[model samples]
Target: MNAVNWGILATGRIAGTFAAALRELPDARLLAVGSRTAESAEAFAGENGAIRAYGGYADLMSDEDVDVIYIATPHPMHHANTIACLEHGKPVLCEKPMAINQREVREMVEVARQRDLFLMEAMWTRCLPVIRRVGEWIEEGKIGEVRMLSAAFGYRTGWDPAGRLLNPGLGGGALLDVGVYPVALAHMVFGGEPTGVDAAAHIGATGVDEQTAMTLTFAGGGLAQLACAVRTNLNQDARIDGTNGHIDIPIFWRASTATLHVEGEAATVINEPSGYHFEAAEVMDCLRAGRRQSSLMPLDETAAIAHTMDRVRSAIGLRYPMDA
Candidate 1:
Protein backbone atom coordinates (compact mmCIF):
# COMPACT_ATOMS: atom_id res chain seq x y z
CA MET A 1 0.00 0.00 0.00
CA ASN A 2 1.14 3.56 -0.70
CA ALA A 3 2.07 5.71 2.30
CA VAL A 4 -0.66 7.94 3.68
CA ASN A 5 -0.07 11.58 2.76
CA TRP A 6 -0.81 14.24 5.37
CA GLY A 7 -1.55 17.93 4.96
CA ILE A 8 -1.07 20.11 8.01
CA LEU A 9 -3.25 23.22 8.23
CA ALA A 10 -1.07 25.36 10.48
CA THR A 11 2.51 26.22 11.39
CA GLY A 12 2.12 26.11 15.15
CA ARG A 13 4.01 24.22 17.84
CA ILE A 14 1.55 21.33 17.89
CA ALA A 15 1.72 21.04 14.11
CA GLY A 16 5.49 20.81 14.32
CA THR A 17 5.24 18.13 16.98
CA PHE A 18 2.86 16.15 14.78
CA ALA A 19 5.15 16.54 11.80
CA ALA A 20 8.05 15.17 13.83
CA ALA A 21 5.94 12.23 14.89
CA LEU A 22 4.95 11.49 11.31
CA ARG A 23 8.62 11.47 10.37
CA GLU A 24 9.06 8.47 12.65
CA LEU A 25 6.20 6.57 10.99
CA PRO A 26 7.24 4.66 7.88
CA ASP A 27 3.72 4.81 6.40
CA ALA A 28 3.02 8.47 7.15
CA ARG A 29 4.16 11.18 4.79
CA LEU A 30 4.14 14.93 5.38
CA LEU A 31 2.84 16.00 2.02
CA ALA A 32 1.81 19.61 2.49
CA VAL A 33 1.48 22.55 4.84
CA GLY A 34 -0.87 25.54 4.83
CA SER A 35 -0.57 28.75 6.81
CA ARG A 36 -1.95 32.27 6.76
CA THR A 37 1.24 33.49 5.18
CA ALA A 38 3.32 32.06 2.40
CA GLU A 39 6.50 32.59 4.38
CA SER A 40 5.18 30.65 7.35
CA ALA A 41 3.91 27.85 5.16
CA GLU A 42 7.17 27.60 3.25
CA ALA A 43 9.21 27.59 6.41
CA PHE A 44 7.11 24.88 8.03
CA ALA A 45 7.07 22.84 4.84
CA GLY A 46 10.84 23.11 4.54
CA GLU A 47 11.49 22.26 8.18
CA ASN A 48 8.98 19.43 8.27
CA GLY A 49 9.87 18.00 4.87
CA ALA A 50 6.45 18.61 3.42
CA ILE A 51 6.51 18.49 -0.37
CA ARG A 52 4.04 21.35 -0.84
CA ALA A 53 3.46 24.67 0.90
CA TYR A 54 0.30 26.67 0.37
CA GLY A 55 -0.15 30.33 1.27
CA GLY A 56 -3.75 29.68 2.22
CA TYR A 57 -5.83 26.80 3.47
CA ALA A 58 -7.91 26.65 0.30
CA ASP A 59 -4.87 25.68 -1.67
CA LEU A 60 -4.08 22.82 0.68
CA MET A 61 -7.66 21.69 0.70
CA SER A 62 -7.59 21.44 -3.07
CA ASP A 63 -4.58 19.13 -3.05
CA GLU A 64 -5.88 15.81 -4.32
CA ASP A 65 -2.66 14.08 -3.35
CA VAL A 66 -3.25 14.65 0.37
CA ASP A 67 -4.97 11.74 2.04
CA VAL A 68 -5.79 13.60 5.26
CA ILE A 69 -5.52 16.95 6.96
CA TYR A 70 -4.57 17.74 10.55
CA ILE A 71 -6.25 20.90 11.81
CA ALA A 72 -3.75 22.38 14.24
CA THR A 73 -5.03 25.92 14.08
CA PRO A 74 -6.16 27.83 17.17
CA HIS A 75 -9.10 26.51 19.15
CA PRO A 76 -11.74 28.52 17.30
CA MET A 77 -10.71 27.55 13.77
CA HIS A 78 -11.22 23.81 14.16
CA HIS A 79 -14.85 23.78 13.07
CA ALA A 80 -14.38 25.62 9.80
CA ASN A 81 -11.08 23.90 8.98
CA THR A 82 -12.37 20.41 9.52
CA ILE A 83 -15.47 21.11 7.48
CA ALA A 84 -13.37 22.49 4.67
CA CYS A 85 -11.21 19.37 4.66
CA LEU A 86 -14.16 17.01 4.70
CA GLU A 87 -16.02 18.96 1.99
CA HIS A 88 -12.96 18.64 -0.16
CA GLY A 89 -12.98 14.85 0.38
CA LYS A 90 -10.13 14.81 2.87
CA PRO A 91 -10.42 13.20 6.24
CA VAL A 92 -9.50 15.27 9.30
CA LEU A 93 -7.85 14.91 12.68
CA CYS A 94 -8.64 18.11 14.50
CA GLU A 95 -6.78 19.38 17.52
CA LYS A 96 -8.28 19.00 20.97
CA PRO A 97 -11.02 21.19 22.43
CA MET A 98 -12.33 20.34 18.96
CA ALA A 99 -13.95 23.73 18.82
CA ILE A 100 -14.64 26.66 21.12
CA ASN A 101 -18.05 25.18 21.95
CA GLN A 102 -20.07 22.01 21.70
CA ARG A 103 -22.43 23.38 19.08
CA GLU A 104 -19.52 23.88 16.75
CA VAL A 105 -18.28 20.34 17.36
CA ARG A 106 -21.72 18.98 16.54
CA GLU A 107 -21.76 20.87 13.27
CA MET A 108 -18.32 19.55 12.36
CA VAL A 109 -19.36 16.01 13.20
CA GLU A 110 -22.48 16.44 11.13
CA VAL A 111 -20.50 17.50 8.11
CA ALA A 112 -18.22 14.49 8.38
CA ARG A 113 -21.16 12.19 8.85
CA GLN A 114 -22.98 13.67 5.87
CA ARG A 115 -19.95 13.37 3.68
CA ASP A 116 -18.95 9.94 4.95
CA LEU A 117 -15.46 11.19 5.73
CA PHE A 118 -13.20 10.41 8.62
CA LEU A 119 -13.06 12.89 11.51
CA MET A 120 -11.30 12.54 14.85
CA GLU A 121 -10.23 14.75 17.71
CA ALA A 122 -6.52 14.70 18.38
CA MET A 123 -6.86 13.62 22.00
CA TRP A 124 -3.46 11.98 21.99
CA THR A 125 -3.74 10.85 25.61
CA ARG A 126 -6.26 8.24 24.55
CA CYS A 127 -3.59 6.56 22.43
CA LEU A 128 -0.83 6.58 25.04
CA PRO A 129 0.48 3.16 26.12
CA VAL A 130 0.33 4.05 29.80
CA ILE A 131 -3.24 5.28 29.44
CA ARG A 132 -4.20 2.12 27.56
CA ARG A 133 -2.68 0.08 30.37
CA VAL A 134 -4.77 2.01 32.88
CA GLY A 135 -7.85 1.07 30.89
CA GLU A 136 -6.75 -2.58 30.87
CA TRP A 137 -6.26 -2.57 34.64
CA ILE A 138 -9.74 -1.21 35.19
CA GLU A 139 -11.21 -3.82 32.85
CA GLU A 140 -9.21 -6.56 34.58
CA GLY A 141 -10.57 -5.51 37.97
CA LYS A 142 -7.12 -4.56 39.21
CA ILE A 143 -8.71 -1.43 40.56
CA GLY A 144 -12.06 -2.54 41.79
CA GLU A 145 -14.94 -0.37 40.64
CA VAL A 146 -13.49 3.00 39.70
CA ARG A 147 -15.29 5.53 41.85
CA MET A 148 -13.22 8.67 41.47
CA LEU A 149 -10.70 10.24 39.10
CA SER A 150 -8.57 13.36 39.62
CA ALA A 151 -6.28 15.04 37.14
CA ALA A 152 -4.50 18.37 36.80
CA PHE A 153 -2.50 19.88 33.92
CA GLY A 154 -1.10 23.33 34.47
CA TYR A 155 1.92 25.53 33.82
CA ARG A 156 3.03 29.07 34.58
CA THR A 157 3.78 31.20 31.58
CA GLY A 158 4.56 34.90 31.24
CA TRP A 159 1.57 37.12 30.73
CA ASP A 160 0.95 38.07 27.11
CA PRO A 161 -2.53 39.21 26.21
CA ALA A 162 -1.98 38.82 22.48
CA GLY A 163 -0.49 35.36 22.84
CA ARG A 164 -2.63 32.29 22.30
CA LEU A 165 -2.60 31.21 25.96
CA LEU A 166 -4.34 34.32 27.29
CA ASN A 167 -6.02 35.77 24.22
CA PRO A 168 -9.79 35.50 24.30
CA GLY A 169 -9.94 36.27 20.58
CA LEU A 170 -7.82 33.20 19.94
CA GLY A 171 -9.96 31.08 22.25
CA GLY A 172 -7.13 30.92 24.74
CA GLY A 173 -7.65 29.70 28.31
CA ALA A 174 -6.54 26.99 30.65
CA LEU A 175 -9.82 25.15 30.24
CA LEU A 176 -9.63 24.85 26.49
CA ASP A 177 -5.88 24.28 26.37
CA VAL A 178 -5.07 22.05 29.34
CA GLY A 179 -8.37 21.30 31.03
CA VAL A 180 -9.63 19.27 28.10
CA TYR A 181 -6.92 16.68 28.71
CA PRO A 182 -8.36 15.74 32.09
CA VAL A 183 -11.89 16.07 30.83
CA ALA A 184 -11.27 13.69 27.93
CA LEU A 185 -9.57 11.18 30.23
CA ALA A 186 -12.55 11.23 32.56
CA HIS A 187 -14.86 10.47 29.65
CA MET A 188 -12.57 7.63 28.55
CA VAL A 189 -12.63 5.99 31.99
CA PHE A 190 -16.29 6.53 32.70
CA GLY A 191 -17.23 5.33 29.20
CA GLY A 192 -19.90 8.01 28.84
CA GLU A 193 -20.78 11.65 29.21
CA PRO A 194 -20.88 13.31 32.59
CA THR A 195 -24.26 13.47 34.29
CA GLY A 196 -23.45 16.81 35.87
CA VAL A 197 -20.77 19.47 35.50
CA ASP A 198 -19.92 21.89 38.31
CA ALA A 199 -17.11 24.26 37.64
CA ALA A 200 -15.37 27.50 38.76
CA ALA A 201 -12.66 29.53 37.08
CA HIS A 202 -10.37 32.47 37.50
CA ILE A 203 -11.09 34.79 34.58
CA GLY A 204 -8.03 36.90 34.08
CA ALA A 205 -7.73 40.50 32.88
CA THR A 206 -7.53 39.19 29.31
CA GLY A 207 -11.05 37.81 29.72
CA VAL A 208 -10.00 34.17 29.43
CA ASP A 209 -9.78 31.53 32.13
CA GLU A 210 -6.43 31.56 33.85
CA GLN A 211 -7.29 28.67 36.08
CA THR A 212 -10.32 26.42 36.31
CA ALA A 213 -11.57 23.61 38.53
CA MET A 214 -14.19 21.11 37.54
CA THR A 215 -16.21 18.34 39.13
CA LEU A 216 -17.85 15.88 36.76
CA THR A 217 -20.45 13.40 37.96
CA PHE A 218 -21.13 10.32 35.89
CA ALA A 219 -24.39 8.38 35.76
CA GLY A 220 -23.02 5.38 37.65
CA GLY A 221 -22.01 7.67 40.53
CA GLY A 222 -18.44 7.99 39.27
CA LEU A 223 -16.83 11.37 39.79
CA ALA A 224 -13.89 13.28 38.31
CA GLN A 225 -12.06 16.23 39.79
CA LEU A 226 -10.20 18.08 37.07
CA ALA A 227 -8.12 21.28 37.20
CA CYS A 228 -6.11 23.34 34.75
CA ALA A 229 -4.21 26.63 34.77
CA VAL A 230 -1.98 28.91 32.75
CA ARG A 231 -0.99 31.38 35.41
CA THR A 232 -0.13 28.83 38.10
CA ASN A 233 1.83 25.61 38.55
CA LEU A 234 -0.04 22.36 39.15
CA ASN A 235 1.17 18.88 40.09
CA GLN A 236 0.27 17.62 36.57
CA ASP A 237 -0.49 14.16 37.88
CA ALA A 238 -3.61 12.01 37.91
CA ARG A 239 -5.08 9.33 40.13
CA ILE A 240 -7.86 6.85 39.48
CA ASP A 241 -9.12 5.61 42.82
CA GLY A 242 -11.37 2.62 43.26
CA THR A 243 -12.82 0.50 46.03
CA ASN A 244 -9.75 -1.70 46.09
CA GLY A 245 -6.82 0.66 45.34
CA HIS A 246 -5.72 3.41 42.96
CA ILE A 247 -3.80 3.87 39.74
CA ASP A 248 -1.34 6.77 39.65
CA ILE A 249 -0.29 8.38 36.41
CA PRO A 250 2.26 11.20 36.35
CA ILE A 251 1.78 13.77 33.60
CA PHE A 252 -1.28 11.82 32.72
CA TRP A 253 -1.98 13.77 29.57
CA ARG A 254 1.33 12.62 28.09
CA ALA A 255 1.87 9.74 30.45
CA SER A 256 4.74 7.38 29.80
CA THR A 257 4.46 5.47 33.06
CA ALA A 258 1.70 4.50 35.44
CA THR A 259 1.68 2.61 38.74
CA LEU A 260 -1.04 0.18 39.68
CA HIS A 261 -1.35 0.20 43.46
CA VAL A 262 -3.55 -2.58 44.69
CA GLU A 263 -4.52 -3.06 48.35
CA GLY A 264 -2.42 -6.14 48.98
CA GLU A 265 -0.24 -6.57 45.90
CA ALA A 266 3.04 -4.88 45.02
CA ALA A 267 2.78 -1.79 42.81
CA THR A 268 3.00 -2.68 39.13
CA VAL A 269 4.44 -0.15 36.71
CA ILE A 270 3.54 0.22 33.03
CA ASN A 271 5.98 2.15 30.87
CA GLU A 272 6.37 3.23 27.25
CA PRO A 273 7.82 6.08 25.20
CA SER A 274 5.55 9.12 24.90
CA GLY A 275 5.05 10.73 21.50
CA TYR A 276 2.36 12.05 19.14
CA HIS A 277 3.15 9.10 16.89
CA PHE A 278 0.72 6.70 18.55
CA GLU A 279 -2.27 8.84 17.61
CA ALA A 280 -0.94 9.24 14.10
CA ALA A 281 -0.52 5.50 13.87
CA GLU A 282 -4.10 4.97 14.97
CA VAL A 283 -5.37 7.40 12.34
CA MET A 284 -3.43 5.63 9.61
CA ASP A 285 -4.59 2.26 10.79
CA CYS A 286 -8.22 3.36 10.78
CA LEU A 287 -7.81 4.84 7.31
CA ARG A 288 -6.35 1.60 5.99
CA ALA A 289 -9.29 -0.28 7.48
CA GLY A 290 -11.77 2.15 5.81
CA ARG A 291 -13.05 3.45 9.10
CA ARG A 292 -14.51 6.96 9.31
CA GLN A 293 -13.96 7.48 13.02
CA SER A 294 -11.68 5.95 15.58
CA SER A 295 -13.20 3.45 17.99
CA LEU A 296 -10.77 4.58 20.69
CA MET A 297 -11.68 8.26 20.24
CA PRO A 298 -15.15 8.18 18.82
CA LEU A 299 -16.85 11.29 17.43
CA ASP A 300 -19.75 10.81 19.83
CA GLU A 301 -17.36 10.93 22.78
CA THR A 302 -15.61 13.95 21.32
CA ALA A 303 -18.95 15.69 21.05
CA ALA A 304 -19.82 14.67 24.60
CA ILE A 305 -16.54 16.08 25.85
CA ALA A 306 -17.28 19.27 23.93
CA HIS A 307 -20.71 19.46 25.53
CA THR A 308 -19.11 18.95 28.94
CA MET A 309 -16.65 21.75 28.18
CA ASP A 310 -19.49 24.03 27.25
CA ARG A 311 -21.14 23.29 30.58
CA VAL A 312 -17.91 24.02 32.37
CA ARG A 313 -17.49 27.29 30.48
CA SER A 314 -21.06 28.30 31.17
CA ALA A 315 -20.64 27.51 34.86
CA ILE A 316 -17.59 29.77 34.96
CA GLY A 317 -19.21 32.54 32.86
CA LEU A 318 -16.43 32.20 30.32
CA ARG A 319 -17.40 33.22 26.82
CA TYR A 320 -15.30 33.41 23.72
CA PRO A 321 -16.02 35.21 20.47
CA MET A 322 -16.73 31.86 18.90
CA ASP A 323 -19.35 30.94 21.50
CA ALA A 324 -22.85 31.49 20.25
Candidate 2:
Protein backbone atom coordinates (compact mmCIF):
# COMPACT_ATOMS: atom_id res chain seq x y z
CA MET A 1 0.00 0.00 0.00
CA ASN A 2 2.94 2.27 0.52
CA ALA A 3 4.72 3.75 -2.46
CA VAL A 4 5.72 0.79 -4.67
CA ASN A 5 9.48 0.52 -4.90
CA TRP A 6 10.58 -0.31 -8.47
CA GLY A 7 13.80 -1.53 -10.08
CA ILE A 8 14.50 -1.53 -13.80
CA LEU A 9 16.68 -4.37 -15.17
CA ALA A 10 18.01 -2.69 -18.28
CA THR A 11 18.97 0.80 -19.50
CA GLY A 12 17.73 0.61 -23.07
CA ARG A 13 15.51 3.17 -24.80
CA ILE A 14 12.30 1.44 -23.71
CA ALA A 15 13.58 1.30 -20.12
CA GLY A 16 14.15 5.05 -20.19
CA THR A 17 10.59 5.66 -21.43
CA PHE A 18 9.16 3.47 -18.66
CA ALA A 19 11.38 5.14 -16.07
CA ALA A 20 10.07 8.56 -17.11
CA ALA A 21 6.49 7.35 -16.79
CA LEU A 22 7.13 5.97 -13.31
CA ARG A 23 8.44 9.39 -12.25
CA GLU A 24 5.03 10.84 -13.05
CA LEU A 25 3.22 8.50 -10.65
CA PRO A 26 3.13 9.75 -7.04
CA ASP A 27 2.58 6.24 -5.67
CA ALA A 28 5.51 4.74 -7.54
CA ARG A 29 9.19 5.28 -6.81
CA LEU A 30 12.16 4.46 -9.04
CA LEU A 31 14.41 2.90 -6.44
CA ALA A 32 17.14 1.23 -8.44
CA VAL A 33 18.51 0.32 -11.85
CA GLY A 34 20.69 -2.60 -12.99
CA SER A 35 22.73 -2.98 -16.12
CA ARG A 36 25.62 -5.04 -17.47
CA THR A 37 28.11 -2.40 -16.38
CA ALA A 38 28.50 -0.10 -13.40
CA GLU A 39 28.89 3.02 -15.52
CA SER A 40 25.68 2.46 -17.48
CA ALA A 41 23.71 1.63 -14.36
CA GLU A 42 24.97 4.70 -12.53
CA ALA A 43 24.24 6.87 -15.56
CA PHE A 44 20.65 5.63 -15.83
CA ALA A 45 20.08 6.00 -12.10
CA GLY A 46 21.37 9.59 -12.19
CA GLU A 47 19.22 10.54 -15.17
CA ASN A 48 16.07 8.73 -13.98
CA GLY A 49 16.26 9.76 -10.29
CA ALA A 50 16.83 6.23 -9.10
CA ILE A 51 18.23 6.07 -5.57
CA ARG A 52 20.53 3.11 -6.23
CA ALA A 53 22.34 1.44 -9.13
CA TYR A 54 23.58 -2.11 -9.41
CA GLY A 55 26.37 -2.99 -11.84
CA GLY A 56 25.04 -6.52 -12.22
CA TYR A 57 21.45 -7.65 -12.67
CA ALA A 58 21.87 -10.34 -9.98
CA ASP A 59 22.80 -7.67 -7.47
CA LEU A 60 19.64 -5.70 -8.17
CA MET A 61 17.44 -8.78 -8.03
CA SER A 62 18.87 -9.63 -4.62
CA ASP A 63 18.07 -6.18 -3.23
CA GLU A 64 15.32 -6.67 -0.63
CA ASP A 65 14.27 -3.04 -0.90
CA VAL A 66 12.82 -3.39 -4.41
CA ASP A 67 9.26 -4.69 -4.65
CA VAL A 68 9.10 -5.39 -8.38
CA ILE A 69 11.25 -5.24 -11.48
CA TYR A 70 10.59 -4.13 -15.03
CA ILE A 71 12.66 -6.22 -17.45
CA ALA A 72 13.61 -4.09 -20.45
CA THR A 73 16.39 -6.25 -21.73
CA PRO A 74 16.58 -7.37 -25.37
CA HIS A 75 14.01 -9.90 -26.57
CA PRO A 76 16.34 -12.88 -26.23
CA MET A 77 16.90 -12.34 -22.51
CA HIS A 78 13.29 -12.09 -21.25
CA HIS A 79 12.89 -15.70 -20.14
CA ALA A 80 16.06 -15.79 -18.06
CA ASN A 81 15.61 -12.28 -16.68
CA THR A 82 12.01 -12.90 -15.64
CA ILE A 83 12.82 -16.19 -13.96
CA ALA A 84 15.72 -14.61 -12.07
CA CYS A 85 13.44 -11.89 -10.72
CA LEU A 86 10.77 -14.37 -9.65
CA GLU A 87 13.41 -16.56 -8.02
CA HIS A 88 14.65 -13.52 -6.12
CA GLY A 89 11.16 -13.07 -4.65
CA LYS A 90 10.38 -10.07 -6.81
CA PRO A 91 7.48 -9.68 -9.23
CA VAL A 92 8.14 -8.89 -12.88
CA LEU A 93 6.84 -6.91 -15.82
CA CYS A 94 8.78 -8.25 -18.80
CA GLU A 95 8.84 -6.48 -22.14
CA LYS A 96 6.67 -8.10 -24.78
CA PRO A 97 7.22 -10.91 -27.22
CA MET A 98 7.70 -12.23 -23.69
CA ALA A 99 10.26 -14.59 -25.13
CA ILE A 100 11.50 -15.55 -28.60
CA ASN A 101 9.17 -18.56 -28.83
CA GLN A 102 6.34 -20.40 -27.15
CA ARG A 103 8.49 -22.90 -25.26
CA GLU A 104 10.48 -20.15 -23.59
CA VAL A 105 7.35 -18.22 -22.73
CA ARG A 106 5.72 -21.28 -21.20
CA GLU A 107 8.81 -21.93 -19.15
CA MET A 108 8.75 -18.39 -17.81
CA VAL A 109 5.04 -18.65 -16.96
CA GLU A 110 5.56 -21.98 -15.21
CA VAL A 111 8.36 -20.57 -13.12
CA ALA A 112 6.24 -17.65 -11.95
CA ARG A 113 3.43 -19.94 -10.87
CA GLN A 114 5.85 -22.27 -9.16
CA ARG A 115 7.32 -19.36 -7.23
CA ASP A 116 3.98 -17.72 -6.45
CA LEU A 117 5.25 -14.46 -7.88
CA PHE A 118 3.43 -11.86 -9.94
CA LEU A 119 4.51 -11.80 -13.58
CA MET A 120 3.13 -9.96 -16.60
CA GLU A 121 4.22 -9.37 -20.15
CA ALA A 122 4.62 -5.64 -20.70
CA MET A 123 2.07 -5.34 -23.49
CA TRP A 124 1.36 -1.76 -22.50
CA THR A 125 -1.14 -1.17 -25.30
CA ARG A 126 -3.62 -3.52 -23.68
CA CYS A 127 -3.67 -1.36 -20.56
CA LEU A 128 -4.62 1.87 -22.36
CA PRO A 129 -7.94 3.41 -21.32
CA VAL A 130 -8.98 3.92 -24.94
CA ILE A 131 -8.41 0.22 -25.62
CA ARG A 132 -10.49 -0.67 -22.57
CA ARG A 133 -13.23 1.58 -23.95
CA VAL A 134 -13.01 -0.20 -27.28
CA GLY A 135 -13.45 -3.53 -25.51
CA GLU A 136 -16.52 -2.14 -23.78
CA TRP A 137 -17.98 -1.00 -27.11
CA ILE A 138 -17.60 -4.50 -28.52
CA GLU A 139 -19.08 -6.19 -25.48
CA GLU A 140 -22.00 -3.77 -25.56
CA GLY A 141 -22.65 -4.86 -29.16
CA LYS A 142 -21.79 -1.42 -30.47
CA ILE A 143 -19.81 -3.19 -33.18
CA GLY A 144 -22.28 -6.03 -33.50
CA GLU A 145 -20.78 -9.52 -33.99
CA VAL A 146 -17.17 -8.83 -34.99
CA ARG A 147 -16.32 -10.60 -38.27
CA MET A 148 -13.20 -9.07 -39.73
CA LEU A 149 -10.27 -6.79 -38.86
CA SER A 150 -7.15 -5.24 -40.38
CA ALA A 151 -4.11 -3.74 -38.67
CA ALA A 152 -0.61 -2.68 -39.69
CA PHE A 153 2.40 -1.22 -37.86
CA GLY A 154 5.59 -0.34 -39.67
CA TYR A 155 8.41 2.20 -40.07
CA ARG A 156 11.46 2.45 -42.28
CA THR A 157 14.85 2.29 -40.66
CA GLY A 158 18.15 2.70 -42.43
CA TRP A 159 20.08 -0.50 -42.95
CA ASP A 160 22.56 -1.39 -40.27
CA PRO A 161 23.28 -5.11 -40.24
CA ALA A 162 24.55 -5.00 -36.70
CA GLY A 163 21.77 -2.77 -35.33
CA ARG A 164 19.15 -4.29 -33.06
CA LEU A 165 16.39 -3.87 -35.64
CA LEU A 166 18.24 -5.81 -38.33
CA ASN A 167 20.32 -8.34 -36.45
CA PRO A 168 18.93 -11.86 -36.38
CA GLY A 169 21.24 -12.73 -33.50
CA LEU A 170 19.45 -10.14 -31.40
CA GLY A 171 16.04 -11.64 -32.22
CA GLY A 172 15.32 -8.66 -34.43
CA GLY A 173 12.59 -8.47 -37.03
CA ALA A 174 9.43 -6.62 -37.93
CA LEU A 175 7.16 -9.37 -36.63
CA LEU A 176 8.72 -9.55 -33.18
CA ASP A 177 9.23 -5.79 -32.89
CA VAL A 178 6.36 -3.89 -34.54
CA GLY A 179 4.24 -6.79 -35.80
CA VAL A 180 3.44 -8.17 -32.35
CA TYR A 181 1.41 -5.04 -31.62
CA PRO A 182 -1.06 -5.75 -34.43
CA VAL A 183 -1.08 -9.47 -33.69
CA ALA A 184 -1.89 -8.89 -30.02
CA LEU A 185 -4.62 -6.42 -30.95
CA ALA A 186 -6.25 -8.96 -33.24
CA HIS A 187 -6.08 -11.62 -30.56
CA MET A 188 -7.77 -9.26 -28.09
CA VAL A 189 -10.56 -8.46 -30.50
CA PHE A 190 -11.02 -12.04 -31.65
CA GLY A 191 -10.90 -13.34 -28.06
CA GLY A 192 -8.66 -16.35 -28.74
CA GLU A 193 -6.00 -17.98 -30.86
CA PRO A 194 -6.36 -18.12 -34.62
CA THR A 195 -7.29 -21.45 -36.15
CA GLY A 196 -5.15 -20.78 -39.19
CA VAL A 197 -2.01 -18.78 -39.88
CA ASP A 198 -0.75 -17.97 -43.38
CA ALA A 199 2.09 -15.53 -43.85
CA ALA A 200 4.77 -14.21 -46.24
CA ALA A 201 7.91 -12.21 -45.55
CA HIS A 202 10.75 -10.49 -47.29
CA ILE A 203 13.82 -11.90 -45.56
CA GLY A 204 16.45 -9.19 -45.65
CA ALA A 205 20.21 -9.49 -46.11
CA THR A 206 20.56 -9.90 -42.35
CA GLY A 207 18.42 -13.07 -42.44
CA VAL A 208 15.45 -11.58 -40.61
CA ASP A 209 12.06 -10.42 -41.73
CA GLU A 210 12.13 -6.84 -42.91
CA GLN A 211 8.50 -7.06 -43.97
CA THR A 212 5.79 -9.59 -43.16
CA ALA A 213 2.12 -9.97 -44.06
CA MET A 214 -0.15 -12.46 -42.39
CA THR A 215 -3.74 -13.62 -42.72
CA LEU A 216 -5.23 -15.28 -39.70
CA THR A 217 -8.53 -17.15 -39.48
CA PHE A 218 -10.29 -17.52 -36.18
CA ALA A 219 -13.03 -19.86 -35.13
CA GLY A 220 -16.59 -18.84 -36.11
CA GLY A 221 -15.30 -17.60 -39.47
CA GLY A 222 -13.59 -14.42 -38.30
CA LEU A 223 -10.59 -13.16 -40.24
CA ALA A 224 -7.75 -10.68 -39.65
CA GLN A 225 -5.21 -9.21 -42.04
CA LEU A 226 -2.04 -7.98 -40.36
CA ALA A 227 1.38 -6.75 -41.43
CA CYS A 228 4.63 -5.42 -40.00
CA ALA A 229 7.77 -3.96 -41.60
CA VAL A 230 11.03 -2.36 -40.62
CA ARG A 231 12.07 -1.38 -44.17
CA THR A 232 8.85 0.45 -45.10
CA ASN A 233 6.28 2.87 -43.72
CA LEU A 234 2.65 1.98 -43.16
CA ASN A 235 -0.58 3.81 -42.27
CA GLN A 236 -0.40 2.42 -38.71
CA ASP A 237 -4.18 2.29 -38.35
CA ALA A 238 -6.66 -0.48 -37.57
CA ARG A 239 -10.29 -1.30 -38.35
CA ILE A 240 -12.58 -3.80 -36.66
CA ASP A 241 -15.52 -4.61 -38.90
CA GLY A 242 -18.50 -6.30 -37.35
CA THR A 243 -21.79 -7.37 -38.85
CA ASN A 244 -23.52 -4.06 -38.11
CA GLY A 245 -20.73 -1.47 -37.74
CA HIS A 246 -17.01 -0.87 -37.34
CA ILE A 247 -14.41 0.95 -35.23
CA ASP A 248 -11.41 2.84 -36.59
CA ILE A 249 -8.29 3.29 -34.50
CA PRO A 250 -5.44 5.51 -35.64
CA ILE A 251 -1.98 4.53 -34.52
CA PHE A 252 -3.76 1.79 -32.67
CA TRP A 253 -0.88 0.38 -30.63
CA ARG A 254 -0.41 3.62 -28.72
CA ALA A 255 -3.95 4.64 -29.55
CA SER A 256 -5.32 7.76 -27.89
CA THR A 257 -8.40 8.16 -30.10
CA ALA A 258 -10.85 5.93 -31.92
CA THR A 259 -14.07 6.42 -33.91
CA LEU A 260 -17.11 4.19 -33.98
CA HIS A 261 -19.32 4.00 -37.10
CA VAL A 262 -22.62 2.21 -36.93
CA GLU A 263 -24.48 1.16 -40.09
CA GLY A 264 -27.18 3.81 -39.76
CA GLU A 265 -26.18 6.25 -37.02
CA ALA A 266 -23.84 9.12 -36.15
CA ALA A 267 -20.23 8.31 -35.43
CA THR A 268 -18.90 8.41 -31.86
CA VAL A 269 -15.32 9.49 -31.09
CA ILE A 270 -13.40 8.78 -27.88
CA ASN A 271 -9.97 9.69 -26.53
CA GLU A 272 -7.77 8.78 -23.56
CA PRO A 273 -4.17 8.74 -22.37
CA SER A 274 -1.80 6.08 -23.80
CA GLY A 275 1.30 6.06 -21.63
CA TYR A 276 3.64 3.40 -20.23
CA HIS A 277 2.35 4.34 -16.77
CA PHE A 278 -0.92 2.50 -17.32
CA GLU A 279 0.85 -0.89 -17.44
CA ALA A 280 3.01 0.01 -14.48
CA ALA A 281 -0.14 0.97 -12.62
CA GLU A 282 -1.67 -2.39 -13.48
CA VAL A 283 1.39 -4.19 -12.07
CA MET A 284 1.21 -2.22 -8.82
CA ASP A 285 -2.52 -2.79 -8.47
CA CYS A 286 -2.00 -6.52 -8.90
CA LEU A 287 0.83 -6.52 -6.36
CA ARG A 288 -1.31 -4.69 -3.81
CA ALA A 289 -4.24 -7.11 -4.24
CA GLY A 290 -1.93 -10.19 -4.10
CA ARG A 291 -2.64 -11.28 -7.64
CA ARG A 292 0.09 -13.17 -9.47
CA GLN A 293 -1.06 -12.38 -12.99
CA SER A 294 -2.95 -9.57 -14.69
CA SER A 295 -6.52 -10.41 -15.66
CA LEU A 296 -6.30 -7.97 -18.56
CA MET A 297 -3.01 -9.42 -19.82
CA PRO A 298 -3.18 -12.95 -18.59
CA LEU A 299 -0.14 -15.20 -18.74
CA ASP A 300 -2.03 -17.82 -20.70
CA GLU A 301 -2.95 -15.33 -23.37
CA THR A 302 0.62 -14.12 -23.50
CA ALA A 303 1.81 -17.66 -24.16
CA ALA A 304 -0.94 -18.15 -26.74
CA ILE A 305 0.29 -15.08 -28.61
CA ALA A 306 3.78 -16.51 -28.57
CA HIS A 307 2.42 -19.74 -30.03
CA THR A 308 0.78 -17.77 -32.80
CA MET A 309 4.05 -15.98 -33.50
CA ASP A 310 5.84 -19.30 -33.69
CA ARG A 311 3.37 -20.38 -36.34
CA VAL A 312 3.89 -17.12 -38.19
CA ARG A 313 7.65 -17.58 -38.14
CA SER A 314 7.35 -21.15 -39.36
CA ALA A 315 5.12 -20.06 -42.20
CA ILE A 316 7.63 -17.47 -43.41
CA GLY A 317 10.75 -19.59 -42.83
CA LEU A 318 12.03 -17.09 -40.30
CA ARG A 319 14.10 -18.58 -37.51
CA TYR A 320 15.97 -17.23 -34.51
CA PRO A 321 18.74 -18.92 -32.62
CA MET A 322 16.43 -19.52 -29.68
CA ASP A 323 13.94 -21.28 -31.91
CA ALA A 324 16.44 -24.06 -32.36
Question: Which digits, one per residue and each the tens of the lDDT, describe model 1 over residues 40-145?
Answer: 9999998989999999999999999999999999998898899989999999999998999889999999999999999999999999888888898988988899
Best by lDDT: 2
Query: Model 2: how large is the Cα RMSD against the reference?
Result: 0.7
The C-alpha stretches of model 2 lying farther than 4 A from their native spots are none
**lDDT score, residue 60, model 2?**
98
In terms of lDDT, the poorest run of 10 residues in model 2 is: 163-172
lDDT of each: 0.93, 0.95
What stretches of model 1 exceed 4 Å from their correct place? none
TM-score of every candidate? 0.98, 0.99
